[model samples]
Target: MKKILLSFFLLTFFQNVVAQTNLYENPNFDELAKTHKIIAIVPFKTQVQLRPKQMKDMSAEQLNRVEKSEGESIQTAMYSWFLKRKKRGDLQNLEIQDPRTTTAMLKKQTIDYNNIMDFTPQELAKILEVDAVISGEFETNKPMSEGASVALGVLFGFFGSTNSATINMSVHNATDGILLWNYNKKVSGSIGSNTEDLINVLMRKSSRRLAYTKNSKDKD
Candidate 1:
């Protein structure tokens, strides 16, 4: 009976993991880059599947409390790393809006955190007046590795290795009001895997890509 229950539980867990959608990412980033200069890093918007270790710390009753506790801090840290990258690269005429300020502004409109896009920072920029908007969701899913390459010690406690959370990024230009770029990245932990390395790496990558190109200025 115990084995049956365990199998049932694991099956239910995998079912939900399979249901996680790949189609959620919008391919049209270029179109989103119109009319804003503030790239606002908001909270993790995904309900990511958990590795065994995370599940150990939280009972079903404590599930909601545990995930919410980490989302805000992680988002802030990731945004900070992004700012550092921009400064390092000497990207001029670029402005990053404070994550906290954006969050507060959204709250004023009675918009829930998940509905951030509907408010569309570009429109807000015209009100507050900014050049561009950058925003994305960082979701962490702890995926375990398969087979005997794994250690027995973890099986006694955990299931296997994890893929960590992939960071999904989107850039929007406030002037034209269109999305510029979007992609999923298995990051090192500016936000997920409980480390800082990934965030810095992501920031650097984004900074280079987001740099105001000479060609773009030529058009202006």
Candidate 2:
């Protein structure tokens, strides 16, 4: 009996490991990241408003209240993941916040975001003093169905959009904002019927496609 139980446990554990695999929509980061050094990941932010749609069963005021919480919740999760990844420190000289936050400084120097494009990556590399920079974006159905109040996103659709998320990401050289590489993925439809499940799928797929390795994926 002991031997049989042990075998079952081992089989279950191995099956669990194999079940955890990434389903990346685009899987080419290995080639691009090989050349670059420092990478920064911006937490996902989107312009999509979860208002007007979720108003089907609630007053405008009610929907607004729900959406306010939704954006903050998703962003918080993204930032937490970013910090955790940073701690792992796989890449070199990574910086999360942009040195240049405000456009006012550029105006003071009479520099245009457009005009700056001509500068080469080597030059920008010299200016920012970093090997490379990463840019990322996210859009999600937002949280809802917390046992009581639905997350912010569902309230956006007429009766709550099947709670989904879409993510688009790219890596660039700080030097002149060159698009060294990019990746995009969307998790919605019947495959993931709601927000919570959508989050699970995105993380799983990204981990695999991001390829910290073939089987294991680093948060960073």
List the candidates' TM-scores in order: 0.56, 0.44
Q: Report lDDT (Cα) of residue 213, candidate 2.
A: 26
Q: Please list the residue runs of candidate 2 whose C-alpha ends up more than 4 Å from where it truly belongs after superposition.
A: 1-37, 43-45, 49-76, 86-131, 143-162, 189-201, 209-220
Candidate 1, lDDT over the whole model = 0.49
Residue-wise C-alpha lDDT for candidate 1, range 1-220, written one tens digit per residue: 9999989865754343321212222344433433334556555554446657656855664444334434554566666665654566543445666877867776777665546557675675554345655456665554211221132224345533334566666655565666555545654322223325345444433444444431222110
Q: What CA root-mean-square deviation does each model show from the true structure? A: 12.8, 9.0
* True-vs-predicted CA distance for residue 174, candidate 1, Å: 2.6
Whole-structure CA lDDT of model 2: 0.44
Off by over 4 Å in 1: 1-38, 51-62, 117-129, 142-163, 187-195, 203-206, 212-220
Model 2 agreement with the true structure over 1-220: per-residue lDDT tens digits:
9999989865753343322222333344465555555443322334333444344656655544444343334434444454555566633433444433312333454533334335443444444445554334455444443411444434333444344455565555554555654556664443233333444444544554543322445432
